[model samples]
Target: MYLADGLVPYTEVFSVLDWWKVAGTRYPTLRKVARDIFAIPVTTVASESAFSTSGRILSEHRSRLTPDMVEVLMCSQDWLRNKCKGEQIM
Candidate 1:
């Protein structure tokens, strides 16, 4: 689903699609890609950014962390990124 030329034929991918929403388009290319070549269209890659921040928080020196400590750090990361409940951008 993630490769060059950006080709993902619809014949094998249909479990998670709603083609009825845009099934009728004037352009063949648009119609073909409407449900076929699915792409992540989030303008801002906040999720990726969050993960990168998390990695920076849990690197080498803090490698020997317990499960609970890891979870707490993950929560802290989400809060820092303003992605958790009651989160704020500071």
Candidate 2:
């Protein structure tokens, strides 16, 4: 049986995991799907931002870089950007 008739917006929160940790117990079946939903990338903003960086990396001056090298550079840039949690404009 559903615990609440409807879900209310939670306020005063920190992380997504924190919300799931508390609410999961109240709704096991829902929680299973909710965790997967939360696991998804959820947006293309990161990829778009990465493409912007890739453009910069492949400019005329650096065009001599080989295909494999280009791939490495692009992947490295994406990894570093994510590691730093840099902000990307939508």
Score every model by TM-score.
0.26, 0.34
lDDT of 1 by residue, 6-87 (tens): 5435677674335444333434566566546555465566766756643455667777888798788777766766764565
Top-lDDT structure, candidate number: 2
Candidate 2 TM-score over all chains jointly: 0.34
Candidate 2, 1-90: lDDT as tens digits:
566557657787668677668778977999988778778875657765745663467778888999999889777777767777975534
Q: List candidate 2 stretches off by more than 4 Å.
A: 3-17, 45-90
- The models' CA-based lDDT, in order, is 0.59, 0.74
Each prediction's RMSD over C-alphas, in Å, is 13.1, 12.6
- In each prediction, how many residue pairs overlap at the backbone (N, C-alpha, C within less than 3 A)? 0, 0
Error in Å for residue 90 of model 1 = 18
